[model samples]
Target: MPYNTSYVPNYIKRQARMVLLLLVLFTGCTEVIELDIQEVEDGLVIYGRISNSNSANEVIISRTRGPETAPTPISGATVRVIDNNGLVRIFLEKEPGVYTMQPSDSPGDFGNSYRLEADVSGRIYRTDFQELMPIIAQDELRYEIGVERDITSSGANIENDVVRIFGDSKLPSDLPEDFFIRWEIEEVYSTLTAFLPVFWFPGAGGRGQCYIQNKLGADQIYLLDGRNIRRSDLNNRPIITRKIDNSFQNKHYFNLIQSSISEENHDYWEKVRTLTITNGSIFDPIVGKLQGNIKSSDPEEEVFGFFEVIGIDTTRLLMTNNDIPVFFVDPCLFLGDKVFPLLTVPFGCVQCLLDEKLIEPGCLSCSAITNSTSRPSYF
Candidate 1:
């Protein structure tokens, strides 16, 4: 599941200015608002999600750590999910504030309703019950190579060719009349290093090739409200876009995780998406509140974050360099270039140096790359 780490922490901080900074990035005019330091209190944030897939279920608790900072994870909290029949399944604490449920534990079953409950220092916090809806499987997932304008960090606009993934789904003709949809995109691809070192180096041994996984199109939100979507089928919904970078050089797989969520949860994410994305227009709203379903026992106590129950269905699309028309030259192509003909070894392939930073020389070892793993079975 996709979680908004930055927005959650800032919302818990309760700084009006930061709140505005989130939902509304800019306005026609700016005003300075002062907050009383002594009155500022750290608020609780509980972000939890349970889905049909056990591996995707987890909960995290934390507290605001003041301004310009990340939230601090709270430890030793009791967390669990309770079904309508009063069956309680406990989540074991895997890390500080991270709690997880095993496969043997209670699974989120469709047609059954559930709610989250947490006990922190004798205080109880819970969310309203939500039913696990039927799964909405993706009917077709396809991609196309196209050109679009992109902005550089230097604020320069340039036209660039890229790949865009699109998805289509049709609801079943029977039963449930309404449904809300959310999509999470994950990218997995294989990468080869220039040098396969003899000695074991983290993610590498003798193999120079490795697999990497990361979120795709995380900056954009993909959601559909059943009420707004009049038809039974959703078509050509733009899912994600990617630049013709090194990630596309090999077998690239995009996992489209479809989640059937509650209208309230969809509203929660919609509110967050609006708060986080901006065009810097003068008509933007100055401020908005980011609230979740979780509530504290004491009405006066403040809490932030959400507890979501959803049904998930996943589908993947594979694309390789051959799929794209534009040929992208590798940044590390110098390993094969004859510019340094006399050099017996690929310069800096053995060890990354100051000059090698420009070409991502660390990738020569594969192990040096973040999230690098052994060749995946599918790859």
Candidate 2:
């Protein structure tokens, strides 16, 4: 079975106790899950999500076993919101699987990075991400960008090369933790036939967290889905592009220019780095077409390492990378509405829009918190 019917939590202070239990059940086992559980257990199969002020296309957290789902639509598990500084939150379970924290003094702080914390019994496990600020503008209303790329030998095909978007404006620090990048572009195919703009995403797109970059083994995920054709070895697998040889369509290549938002996280708020990829650049083998709408969006960004400290001031941001583009800088790249929503089980996460307020580097939401009160570096 690919899922489990129940979960159990045991309190064993010694390592020996853990080893013994694992030895009894680990040789080989498989299980799959179905709708609501027939029973409940202390060790809950948690469910939650992350979302933003944008429209309704929400994705959820899922294992490698299948496609993405909306936030598992949860309500009972304990929810913890941890700032990069280690300041932790023990959210109150307001409903069955819904957890709530008192509305903050203002909105979430942008300059500061945050993560999540979940506890079951005495065990505390952490996701690769944290709570974060909303990446948008406050004062100056609106923003836009144009993207185009040259083709390379890589399987990536440089197709639609332009992208644009409108937003209030952006501050060096307003970038959110779940950076959900969106690229609104002209439809590639005919509307009557091609109803939607060919949107590209990482690991798992729209459906859930699968499209999130770094969410899973980027290139390797193709194997899990059985989407590629193999040679002798799995490493030698081949991709299956949409149009082959003579089937290539020129009209299909040019995406109509329209309102759009492509993403490439410009800063190190989350302690990660993106490539020099432009709008039409192809990324990994599994991910083909570099449509005019490039999506650098995902709920959890990879935090390869860290800096001066978590939850610090703008001063903490010193141009850390030398090998980059001048257009690239601290938290400059993101969508007007959201980056990505946190994947909370059955239901994806949700984030509200920026409260048309003034944006100053040091000011996040209305309650600007600084490292004056430091925290742990759990991320």
Candidate 3:
């Protein structure tokens, strides 16, 4: 899985905006005040996951810091996973504080209880045995094209051509009513820049049509409970939506992953999702330190995040250019005879490119825009 830190600040700003909006609506006005907040000692933050897939299992241990400081990864810790049958597998520290299970080890067994144990600085932290829940495969994955108005950073409204992905799944009547379901999505798309005129600079490699593929999906969490569902089968339930842009100008693919999780795991993620959406507002649920299944040997020690074992079902859907409306200007328009000096150029070409900042290097390379130069196996 790819890790992106850029979304963290954007997520925080969006939550802050929601809080301000609610405050003004309820109080009729808003006042800015400064409060001196005492920083607490950093505590342990652990994140780990085990799945039924062949993907490597990983555990990340880090220590929290002040709001203005970034969390530091904790290294030199001993970590292992133990099954109910007494089978033990030690995780190797592949990076600073990242530990991964060996490829020779089992991915994970469904319906079996597993426990995570870690010793950091002579303090043992462990989680109660968590059983992997069984998941029902998604019946279908589909999408529809539509249009919506989006507000820009300057508060200007613009029409956006969007593609919404939906899924269908049938629940077994015999399953427990409290079963929890979560959805994750991954998008695979190819990029082409062959249409652009080839330009060579000193020490620059040849630039031509290179089929590039990229994956996109993270940050968004969708959760549901079987007990709250009224129907046995879900149809046309929206999963995610993306604004159709240059990234979708060619063929695009979506991989939808549905997972069944334990109630404890579901509750932990639900609270986290709520925290991100609510920030800290009077109308929001009272904010508290998030508790996980992991427990420290010392009663006063604090632990954050969780380790989860889940069963997943995945389905893939493909989309072509005809499936979505294109609303983007030609990227090459910015070059304007710069790469092709013999061609007649338009008036105010330099000013237009400078104003739009489209002369930047990315616009000339489709692979540099969003995806990678390497094509995906499926593509």
The residue ranges of model 1 lying beyond 4 angstroms of the native Cα positions read: 1-41, 149-159, 196-204, 273-289, 326-378
| Residue lDDT tens for model 2, 26-129 | 11222221212111111123223222211111111111111122112333445565556666545565444444443341223535554445543444434444
Q: Roughly what TM-score does model 1 have, to 2 decimal places?
A: 0.74
lDDT tens string, model 3, 44-102?
77778776765536777877564445457779999999988999878888777778887
List ranges where model 2 is wrong by over 4 Å: 1-75, 104-107, 121-123, 129-180, 183-379
Query: Each candidate: how many clashes?
Result: 1, 62, 0
Per-prediction TM-score: 0.74, 0.24, 0.72
lDDT of each: 0.64, 0.23, 0.60
Q: In candidate 1, list every pair of residues with a backbone clash.
A: 23-275
- Ranked by lDDT, the better of candidates 1 and 2 is 1
Model 3 TM: 0.72
Model 3 stretches astray by more than 4 angstroms: 1-40, 137-139, 150-157, 193-199, 207-220, 273-288, 327-338, 341-376
